[model samples]
Target: MKNEIDKKLTDKNIKPTAMRQLVLKVLTEQKTATSLPELELEFEKADKVTLYRTLKTFEENKLIHKIEDGTGSVKYALCQDTCECHPQDLHVHFLCDKCKKTYCLNDIPVPTINLPIDFSLESVNMVVKGVCFNCKK
Candidate 1:
């Protein structure tokens, strides 16, 4: 597992530090997107600044993507191996109202929009809110 985490960081051109490795492991093991507060609670001994910086580095290197699930708090998820963190590479995200968990629906591609010639697209975030399977059960 450590080897895989190291490789993932290296593949994204990021140096594999201990904190980074731990963060990646936690994110990869989680079924839903994670928030900074959640991670802090998981790592009680870890410094908030260090964790925040690690997350920022991951985002900057395209190792993870941020999702705004309309709940005010931002969440982070590991990016797919093929994802370049570009607008076209982004997919849809789902937020479960019951469980309050956010999931990445990578299989469902985001539809392209026909905008005016003057319109320029920087990024796109599509979040569908509903009850997740686990919540329904």
Candidate 2:
């Protein structure tokens, strides 16, 4: 299951260290996107610096997307499909209010719209907050 992770890092020129592998392992095994604190708790052996750097590398390589759902906590999720990091497409992410978990809505592709020549947009992340199925039940 984690083999894909190693391959991804290798493809992106990211060296796979023990800590880096653990970070990817955590992300792939996660039920939903996670924040720094959540990840810290998830991997007790991983320090802040390591986790932060891993997240940065993953984001830079377009393997994950950041989710700032206006809740103050910065979250991250796996980039299952094409994202703006590649072609500047909008992506809508879901934030579960009850669990404070975020999930990427990969099926609903982000719409593209034309912008004025004067206005140039680099990237955008759409976030929607609500209770998840488990929380609602």
Candidate 3:
């Protein structure tokens, strides 16, 4: 698992430090987007500054993407293998109101919106909030 995490970081042109590997592994294993507070609980011994910097580096390297579900706190999730996370590569995100979890709907591509000629697009964030299947059950 460590080897895999290292490779993933290298693939994104990031040097796989111990902290980066640990943080990435946690995100990958969770199978869902996670917030800083949640991660803090998981890595109680880790310095908040170090963890925050690690997350920032991952985002800068396109190794992960941030999710803003209008929930006040931001979340981060592992990007798809081919995801560059550009506007065209953006996809829909689902936020479960009950569980307060954010899910990346990678299979559902975000529809392209034709903006005015004068407008430019850099990034797009679309989140659909509702009770998830597990919550309904």
Candidate 4:
């Protein structure tokens, strides 16, 4: 697992450090998108600054993508290995209202929009809110 983590970081041109590896491990283990506060709780003695930096580094490297699910808190989830963080690579996100957990709906691509002249698409954030299967049960 450690080797796999290291390889992933290195492939993204991010130097594999202790903090980076640990944070990546946590992100990889998550079933839903996670916020900074939620990630801080995972560590016994987390350096807030370091954790923030790690997340920023990951985002910059396209190892993870941020999600704004209208919950006020920005969450992050690991990107697919082939993900380039491009507009076309973006997908719809599912936010479970009952559980308040944001999940990556990877199979569902965001619909294409025909922009007006002179307008260009940069990114799109589409979130579908509903009760997740776990909550429905």
Candidate 5:
């Protein structure tokens, strides 16, 4: 796990720090996504600002994908295997309303559209909002 994060950080040209590692470690803990505040509360030593900066860095490197809920809250989930900011690992992310977390629907790959000749694709973020199974009662 550490090696994977290290390699990703290096690829993003970001110097790995203890605080950054801790923030990433917390994100990796979930089977779903997490918010900045959620992570701050979960990590006793991580302050809100530090956690946000760490998340910013991670998102910049495509290490994680941000799930945007219409309510205006943002959540994040870990990148799947072979997520090289390409369409392969890019897909619709599901955000459970009740649980207030995000999830990568890897089984459902993102749709692709042909672009103009000069256009180049970088990364994509698709989010589906609803309540998750665990939250349904």
Candidate 6:
């Protein structure tokens, strides 16, 4: 597990520090997108600033992506191995109203948009809000 975590970090050109390795481990275990506050709960003794910085570094290196699911709190999820955070690489996010958990719909790619000649695409964040399968059950 440690070797895998280290490899993931190294692949993203991020040095595998203790904090980063631990944070990445937590992220890997998540079934849904995670927020800073949620991650804070995982590492009670660790400094919040350090965790935030580690997340930022991972995001900067494209190891993870951030989601703004209209809940005001930004959530982070591990990116697909081939993900480069491009427009076409973006996918729909599902925000469960009941469980309040956000999930990455990786199989559902965002539709292509036709923009004016002078315009360019930057990023797309499409969030679908509804009750998740677990919540429905």
Best by lDDT: 6
lDDT (tens digit, per residue) of candidate 2 on 60-116: 887777888877989888776444364444467888878877787776656776888
lDDT of 4 at 24: 97
TM-score of candidate 2 to 2 decimals: 0.86
Q: What are the root-mean-square deviations of the candidates from the true structure over C-alphas?
A: 0.8, 2.0, 0.8, 0.7, 3.1, 0.7
TM-scores for every candidate against the unseen true structure = 0.97, 0.86, 0.97, 0.98, 0.75, 0.98
Ranking of models by lDDT: 6, 4, 1, 3, 2, 5
Going through the candidates in order, what is the number of backbone clashes in each?
0, 0, 0, 0, 0, 0
* Candidate 5 steric clashes: 0
lDDT tens readout by residue for model 5, 27-102:
7778877877778788767577877888888887778777775657788887764676676667888877786667
TM-score of candidate 4 to 2 decimals? 0.98
Q: Residues 1-137, candidate 1, lDDT per residue (tens digit)?
A: 99999999999999999999999999999999999999999999999999999999999999999999999999999999999977789899999999899999999878897789999988889999999999898
Better of 3 and 4 by lDDT: 4
Q: What residue runs in model 6 are displaced by over 4 Å at the alpha carbon?
A: none
- Computed on alpha carbons, the lDDT of every model, listed in order, comes to 0.94, 0.78, 0.92, 0.95, 0.76, 0.96
lDDT score, candidate 6, position 21: 95
Error of 5 at 94 (Å): 1.4
Pairs with backbone N, CA or C atoms under 3 Å apart (clashes), candidate 5: none
- Candidate 6 lDDT tens digits, 65-96: 99999889999999999999999899999999
lDDT of 3 by residue, 22-123 (tens): 999999898679999999998999999999999999999998999989999999999989989888779999999899999999988889989999998888
RMSD of 4: 0.7
- Candidate 4, overall lDDT? 0.95
Output the TM-score of candidate 6: 0.98
Name the weakest run of 10 consecutive residues (lDDT summed) in model 4.
38-47
**Order of the predicted models by TM-score, top scorer first:** 4, 6, 1, 3, 2, 5
